[model samples]
Target: MLNIALAQLNYTVGDFSANTTAIISHMRRAAAASADIAVFSELAICGYYPGDLLEDSSFLARCDAALDEIIRTSAELPELVTVVGTARRNNGPGKPLHNSLLAIRNGQIIAEYYKQLLPTYGIFDEYRHFEPGPQTACTLSVREHRVGFMICEDGWNQPGLDYKVNPFDALKQATPELVISINASPSDIGKRKKRHSTISKACQETQLPILFVNQTGGQDQLVFDGASFAVTPDQGVVFEASQFEEDFQCIGFDAGAFMKDGLPLLASALVDLPVEEFTRRQILLGLRDYARRCGFSKVVVGSSGGIDSALTLALAAQALGAENVIAITMPSVWSSEGSVSDSVDLCKNLGIRLHTHPVADLVKQFSTGFEHSFDTPLRGLPLENLQARIRGTILMEYSNSFGALLLTTGNKSEISVGYCTLYGDTNGGLGLIGDLYKTEVYALSRHINQQAGRELIPEPIISKPPSAELAPDQKDTDSLPPYEVQDEILKWHLEGDRMPPAEAKAARNHVQGLQTSEEGRQLVARILAMVARNEYKRRQAPPLIRVRSRAFGSGRQMPLAAKY
Candidate 1:
């Protein structure tokens, strides 16, 4: 029997000391548990997805030193073998370095395996730094069992998305008893389920029981949900780790079956989380990690008593204790009584602090200055935008004075069509709801209240119509289609086939129904024009937590000066 310990750790990008220490700690824990081999996620020594940091010689030097230390540290547990991901110089390659997996035992580097597949699509840009490794399979014999290894993207090349290799096939040719794959896979909606299906398919093709280990925690826009698992042709995901958090598990393998504590894993543990719940957990973890890593323990949100800000504040309070969340209500002349009162009730219900920072004076000052300087009264779109800008400026002042992170509250609907003012509501260090549509924002707010078992977001905040309150009685519907219709159009336009299967189909049908008439076609054209014109605005927005398959930023890139 081979006892394998999988370490799903949360690592800091480019912090070699912290990353190395974390790896060593997990190695020691696995050794103490009498594990035959301890496996870490891809790029554990220096963290995964370092982007241009990998190009720095000093960073790689630190990684080399850290790797040497880890090799020496493995000596403390003489019987345990360690497999970890790090980078090494490719002295004779197409690229300057190789993304390598190191195996160390008893203070010696036994074998080194370089990643053959460099993913360059979507949020991945591995090809920019590292060259592909050799085509040979790596296997190490331990406890009378032959184990194989593959990096994150090596085993993902299927018939549809064909790369130059099929790593599992080569590894299977070696007749290994099992395969262990380390990954730094980022999480999104339905990612865990898709990962399981892909890995299970590989197991069936190779007929090899496989152990998959992944990294956890947030790295800016990307969040890795460490839902690692063990799969076999017969059982398919027999043992699984935790999701959206750090986890470590040791499983046993004998005669092609995986057992946790010498027994089969429960079937109930293999189910997928509900997609909404998955999104909620991902956002919470992403927000917490982003704030923690950026050195801010507190967050300040401009609460407008709307669904977007209400949900953002509620999620913030939940992620980083209620005491750490501060809500600033900057009500203007156009703001309704329910706006400030609902915000007050929401803060009280959430046990968070609330401050009134009325922006009517700021709005008036900006309007007067604009009319004087330009010789034209700032009204219509410009005036509405001034109100938003005033509120944004006040919130920034709070962020500056308190040293708390400012959280932007614009949802995907507003963000897509440029409904948000550039320097106004977009003046946050980070955003919590930028990836969510207006419809999803309402759904998540309801979910939060349901989970809280009380009206934590205030009933008025949940029930009230969504508006910027920048102008008198201004509602979002006056400018854009109802969210029920606009969100479907957005899903069809922005995401296309990349959205949820059912959602994409429904959205396509809804968009077609809208396009059947001249008015519907004109509405679609208008929304498209706005989305295209707003690229400059989105480019200036701060990093937001990504929850969907096709989010803004790196997941969806658009040319600022181009027309399609």
Candidate 2:
């Protein structure tokens, strides 16, 4: 029987001290548990996806020192085999470094394998730094059991996929009893389900039981959900770890079946989290980690009493304690009485402090200065944008005075169509809901209330129509289509086939129907043009917590100078 320990940890980029300490602690724990093998996620020594940091000679030197320390520590636990991921220098290679996995026992490196598949797609640019390993399978013998190893993207290239070579096919030829795949997979909507389906398919094809280990925690725009698991050819996923948090588990492999304690384990399906709940957890973790890592305990938000700001404030309050969140109501002459009152109510419900900072006088001052200098009345779009800019400036001032991060409130719909003013509503350190559609912003707000069992977001705020309150009777619909219609068009245009199956089908059907009529066709063309033209604005916006398949920041790249 082979007892394997799975260590699912959260590693911060460039923090070598903390990453090495965590790995060694987990290694000691695995030894105390009397396990045959202890496995950690990819790049546990230096953290995953260090980006351009890989180019620094000092950073590579630090990585080497950390690996050496881990190797020396393994001597104390000679009976336990430790598997870890780190970067290694490639003397003869295309790139200067190789993404490598090392198996250590008794202070010696027994087996070392370089990752063959370096993904260069969305949110991944592995090919930029690390040279791909030659197409070969790496296996090691442990206590009469043969175990194969593969990195994150290697196991992903199952049959009929995009990659030229299938790493799993090479592994099957070697005929190991089980496979151990280390991953740094980032989380998104429906991604956990896709992982299960893909890994299970690989087990069936290779007729090999597999142990998949992944890292947990937020890394800027990417959040990794550590839902590690063990899958058998006959039972699929039998033993699974936790999601959205750190977890560790030890299971037995005996007679070709997984065992917990001593008995055969029953296969259980991964329960799918509700869409709103998944989004809530993802954003909360994202905000918490982003703020903590950036060295801020508090956050400030511009609460316009609109759905977007209301939701952003509520989430910020939840993520960084209500006491750490401050809401500023920057109302102008165009702002409604309900705007201020609703913000007050929302803050009261959330137990957050609210400050009223009127911007009417400030807007008047700006208009006077502009008219005097430019000899033109500050009217129409400029005036409307002036209000937003004033509010954004006030929020930034609060953030500066309080040493707190400013949170931007624009949602995906407005962000996609260039509806937001540059340097106006976009002034913040981070965006809380930039990936969410206007429709999703409302749905998640309601879900928060339902989960709290009270009106945490204020019922009036939820019931009110969304508006920037920058002009008289300014509804979002005056500029763009209703959120329900616009969001569908965005899903079809922005994400396309990358969306989940149900959403992709729905978007395709919606766009196909829209193309049936001339007016509908014109509207579709206009939205597409708006999205294309807004690349410059989005390029300048702060990075948001990515909850969908294709968010505006890192996932979707477009040329600002080009027209389609």
Candidate 3:
């Protein structure tokens, strides 16, 4: 019988001391469990996807030292084997390093495997720093059981995939009793289901039980949902760790079947989180980690009393306690009474402090200066945008004065069409809902209210017509299509094939139906042009928590100066 301890941990990028401490603490816990092997996620030594930090010799040296420390600690627990991921110097390679894994026992490196697949696709740029390892399988004899190793992307090539070499094929030749894959997989809508299906297919094909380990944390815009799981050839997924949180648990492997408490483990079905609930948990974790990592206990959001700002403030208050979340309402002359009142009610419901800052005087000052300097009155679209900028500046002032992180509240629908002013509403340290569509913002707000069993976001804020309140009687529909129509177009235009199968099909059908008429055709063309024209604005916006497969950041890179 082989007992395997799975450590689903959260690590900060480039923080070697903290990372090492976490690894060692988990290793000690695994020892207490009397496990044969302890496994950590990919790049646990220095965190995953360090980007250009791999270029620093000092960083690489520290990574090496961290590995040495883990190895030395293993000497104390001579009977336990520890598997960890780190970067190693590659002597003969295109890149300077290799994403390597080390197996330590009794203060000695027994087995080392370099990751064969260096994914360069969306949200992954492994090829920029590390060369792909040789097409060979790495295995070791552990407690009389043969175990094989693969990194994140190695086992993804089951069949009919694009990769040139199949790492699993090499592993099949090695004929190990079990396969262990370490991953730093990021979470998105329907990603958990995709991971189980893909890995289960590979397990059945190879007829080898596999243990998949993943990390949990919010790294920039990406949040890795640590649903580390174990799969057998007969039973697809037998066990899974916690989602959106750090977890550690040990399972017994005996006679090629997983066991818990000395009995055969039953196949556990994956309970996929509802779309709105999934997005809520994802954004909460993302904001909490972003705030903690950036050294801010409090966050300030410019609450416009619209669905987007109300949702942002509610989520912020939940993530960082109510005391740590501050809402600033910057109402202008064009702002409605309901806007200020709704913000007040929302903050009261959330138990957070709300500050009202009127921006009418500030707008007048900026408008007077702009008209005097440029000999052109700041009116029409320019005047409307000035109000937004004034609000953005006031929010920033609170952020600076109170040492709080500013949260931008523009949703995907507005951002795609450039409805948001560049320096005005887009100012913030981090965007909590920038990736969510305006339609989704409402859905999640309702979900939050339902979960709380009360009007957490307030009924008026949820029922009110969407507007920027930058002009008299201005509604978002004045300049853009209704959210339901605009979101479909944005999804079809922005994400397309990257979206989940159901959503993609729905979006495609909606767009195709719209194209059947000349008016709809014109609307589609106009929205597409707006999205293309607004690329410069998105390029300058702060990073938002990514909840979908194709977020605006690194996942979708479009040239700003190009035209179709």
How big is the positional error of residue 464 in model 2, measured in Å on the Cα after superposition? 1.4
Query: Over the stretch 272-354, how does candidate 2's per-residue lDDT look in tens digits?
Result: 89999999999998999899889999999888888888999999988999999999998889889899989988999989999
RMSD of each: 1.4, 0.9, 0.9
For lDDT, candidate 1 versus 2, the one ahead is 2
What count of clashes does model 1 give?
Answer: 0
How are the candidates ranked when ordered by lDDT, highest leading? Answer: 3, 2, 1
Off by over 4 Å in 3: none
lDDT per residue for candidate 1 within 196-315, as digits (tens), equals: 888888888879988889999999999999989889898787778888889888888888888888886644556677766787898999999899889999999988888888899889
| Model 2 regions more than 4 Å off | none
Worst 10 residues of 1 by lDDT: 264-273
For candidate 3, write residues 1-564 as lDDT tens digits: 999999999999999999999999999999999999999999999998799999998998898898889989999999999999999889994889999988999999999999998888888889999989999999999989999999989988869386889999889999999999999999999889989999999999999999999999999999999999989999899999999999999999878898888888889667899999999999999999999999999999988888998999899988989999999888889889999989989999999999888888888998899989999988999899888887888888888888999999989988889989999999998999989998899999999999999999999998888888888898889989888998999999888988889899999999999999999999999999999899999999999999998898898899989987
